[model samples]
Target: MTGNARLDLAIFDAVDIDTVGAFYAGLTGWDIVRKDGERFGLRTPEGQEIEFQRAPDHVPPRWPGQEFPQQFHLDLETDDPQAQVERAIRLGATRLADGPAWITMADPAGHPFDLCQADGVGPVMRLFAVTVDAPDASELARFYADLTGMRLVHDHPEGALITDGERNLMFQRVDDYNPPRWPDPAYPQQAHLDLVVDDLVTAQARALELGARRLSAGGERYRVFTDPADHPFCLVW
Candidate 1:
């Protein structure tokens, strides 16, 4: 199937944009492309952008638990996990867990991410995937696959993966996932995805037909909608 939208940006809500933005920039070696009083944007070597928006009253997620669940986390591939972990720690990341193949750490804003050991000799580090939590990984994966027209690369009961070769989107099974209530600061959306489309009207209609719920929040150039799993995403023209 053809993709209705192209993944453009991944945005995170942080209490302090400077701290969070600087931490990610130091870790990923990405340059700050856009910076303002309340918002900061960093662009990867490949031009993929990760933005952080200031949310003074942002409520951080509690990972490894259902209470204030983490809506999403980034997986970064690194050649030397130990070195990267050390660097991350120095950059204000707190070590959360350790595994043979991956090391989990929480960023300055309390978002958990993994420093996964890469297989071959490549760049020192690169973004591996953007993973979201769901009650049913298989079902959510299918929904995103159909919505983004990405190929399902891995499917299992616990997790699922969809990719367009370079970039990947993953779904992990959470026992009791607590979705975000957007437009409500009490239960904030920690992070969200922005998808670009050629035609906003057609794309919004298609998204709604594919089990997406229209949200009341949006602007002229874009419209907001929540996926089947209730994570906020935008269709931008």
Candidate 2:
């Protein structure tokens, strides 16, 4: 393992950038740390960075459906799951489901997330895991484990979770999953990940060797590649 890569940012595409940015900032109590004409961003207190890009005519995904399946979802940990759910509703989240351990909610932009119960009170929300939908969870998990040098932390029949020291990523099997086509408006990549590397050439070579296909060269500083499951991720130096 190179051990030289780290997750730099998670980018979301939203139809209304300001509204989505405000929703997340209010929900996480994070300030807008970066902003430009087309993008907005926030850095959580725990150092996780997220950015939103404006996508004109974007159609929010309909989770658990064939129309536009949710390619990914974030899991947030809360000491008081119910209370957190209530607060999120006040911040424009719609509760989709509630249970003893986890509560599902959709954000203002219709991205699904889970408020999972935790042992103690901490930040209003903590970035727990970014879960991706795949036809073969085991295969995707192994591919990322090799690419990021993260260890497999949790294994289930239909899913698996992996973690580097700083970030956690999960993969879950989705029935009849419809993968997004890059730069396709009808089936857009709702969100994507950015990984920072010290040497882009070395990282790109290793990624191709480990089963990633080059989709586009974003620029001298960034390049886009798709994982085995067709999810796009950028390797940046």
Candidate 3:
């Protein structure tokens, strides 16, 4: 929390928890470590975890929609993009498009993810980055860099990337992006990050200094706040 904060989770809010959990577990060969009626969690071989929570009345975001946009997307790394795309399709993912360096696809719950070809990184599918949509990529990246003390690796008009060595976070420029209304299902939070910190009060103060707006002060070990781009994230001890 003081020196380097770790990303604990990349969570998705899905209509069917089991379906989404199964899709990611099969897609990544990760173990579904936690499962209940309301929540399903997967622990990757590398120890990374992604979870999906039940939202019966969830309305999936429409891609390229200004009204209800995809707030974020997961970037998966693979040595063979084509084979991974095929495998994803077999596991209930819908191929959206294939870019020159990445293939865009949606999971069973209609959340978009990218399968990017890696340069001899590994054959196993791995979560590379969690890209968040923002009004200004560079600005958002700077905010996170200050908050986490991470380096700003990439800076561009289209997008900007930041990393804390262990995890990568990207910010993509989105025109007329609408910030999600916290606790309001109308503007649902499609995805969110859980950052681990040491002290709540000290970390919260540092976060606010870095432009994080406190949304809620609930829970004994966690608090909810919105980033400069209005993406909700939790600071947990």
User: Evaluated with lDDT, which candidate comes out highest?
Assistant: 1
Candidate 2, position 103, lDDT:
93
How far residue 29's Cα lies from its native spot in candidate 1, in Å, is 1.3
Candidate lDDT scores, in order, read 0.85, 0.84, 0.84
Ranking by TM-score: 1, 2, 3
Using Cα atoms with residue i matched to residue i, what is each candidate's TM-score against the true structure? 0.94, 0.93, 0.92
Give me the displacement of residue 101 in model 2, in angstroms.
Answer: 1.2
Clashing pairs in 2: none
Evaluated at residue 207, the lDDT of candidate 2 is 90
Q: Which candidate is the best by TM-score?
A: 1
| C-alpha-based local distance difference test score of model 1 | 0.85
Give the poorly placed runs of model 3, Cα more than 4 Å off.
1-4, 121-123
lDDT of 1 by residue, 1-237 (tens): 354687888899899999999998889887899889888998876666789989888888777777787789988888889888889999999999998899999999999999999876365357888888888898888887877788899999699999877568899998877888887777689899998888888888788888899999889999999988888999888
Model 2 error, position 216 (Å): 3.1
RMSD each, Å = 1.6, 1.7, 1.9
Q: What's the distance in Å from true for residue 78, model 2?
A: 1.0
Superposed by TM-score, candidate 1 places the C-alpha of residue 212 at a distance from the truth, in angstroms, of: 0.3
Q: Which should have the higher lDDT, number 1 or number 3?
A: 1
